[model samples]
Target: MWQQKTIHLAEKPRGFHLITEEVLAQLPEIKNIKIGLVHLLLQHTSAGLTLNENADPTVREDFLQYINRLAPEDLNYLKHTYEGDDDMPAHLKSSLLGVELMLPITQGQLNLGVWQGIYLGEYRNFGGVRQLIVTIQS
Candidate 1:
């Protein structure tokens, strides 16, 4: 079986936010799948998607700090500043982190690890609502 949907995620500020529950809430059909895979693609260049520690908020904070260091906005050589100072840096961070995720679904639920969770890498301060193309194969 195959299923697909475009989910509109809520707007968020710049940070790593846990979105496991939010995604699940939108896809109740996952409960019908006995065993499958779900692929999520973020339809944006300025933001990204990743899976990481869900139990600790500090991990998300650390991720923000690390990525900020890796793609600092203070560089004066950026050519894509038409959007803003964070535009080029946001793209860099999105590329580094990626914009898609594929995870296992078992027994009608996402088979994530005990400490794992879906993260939306909101690189822009006012990225507005994000879009995710969710595909499920059972």
Candidate 2:
């Protein structure tokens, strides 16, 4: 079996946000798959996807803080500044973090760890609504 869908996520501030529930809520078809794979692709260059801690909000905050330090907007060498200070940095962060994820499905549910969850790395300050293409194969 195979299924695919595009889900639109509302605009969010620059931070790492837990979106596992949001993604699953939009894809109830996973309930029918006993064993499969779920592939998620975030369709944007200035944003990214990852898997990380889901229980603590501080983990998300720390991720934002650390990534900002790694790709600061104040770098004078960046030439892509037309979009805003956060734009180029957002692109860098997106590349470093990546834009896709593939997770296993077991017994009709995602086989994520107890502390693991899908994260949307909203690197831009005003990235607007993000689109995620979800593909499931069983």
Candidate 3:
């Protein structure tokens, strides 16, 4: 079986946000698949998707801080400056972090580690609503 859907995520500020529950909430059909794979694609160039620590909020904060250092918006070499200061840096950060994720599904639930959860890396200061294309295959 194969299924696909596009879901809109609420706007978020520049930071790393835990969105595992949000994604699951939008896909109740996932419970019907005992074994499968869920593929998530963030349909934007200024944001990213990843799996990481869910037990602590500080981990998300640290992620935002570290990522900003890796792709600071103050770089004078950026040519894509028409959007804004955060625009070019957002693209750089998105490329480094990526915009897709694939996770295993088992026993009618996501087979993520105990401390693992899906994260949305909101690279832009005002990224607004984000769109995600979720595909499930079993």
Best by TM-score: 1
Cα lDDT tens digits, model 3, 14-75, are 89999999999999999989999999999999999999999999999999999999999899
Model 1 stretches with alpha carbons more than 4 Å out: none
Q: Considering TM-score, where higher is better, how would the candidates rank from best to worst?
A: 1, 3, 2
Leading candidate by lDDT: 1
Q: How close is candidate 3 to the true structure, as a TM-score?
A: 0.98
The whole-model lDDT of each prediction reads 0.96, 0.93, 0.95
For candidate 1, write residues 16-124 as lDDT tens digits. Answer: 9999999999999999899999999999999999999999999999999999999999999889988899999999999999999999999999999899999999999
Report the alpha-carbon TM-score of model 1 versus the true structure. Answer: 0.99
Candidate order by decreasing lDDT: 1, 3, 2
Task: For each candidate in turn, give its C-alpha RMSD to the true structure in angstroms.
Answer: 0.5, 0.7, 0.6
Residues 12-127 of candidate 2 have per-residue lDDT tens digits of 88799999988888989989889999999999999999999999999999999999999999999999988999989999999999999999999989999999999999998899
Q: What's the C-alpha lDDT at position 24 in model 1?
A: 96
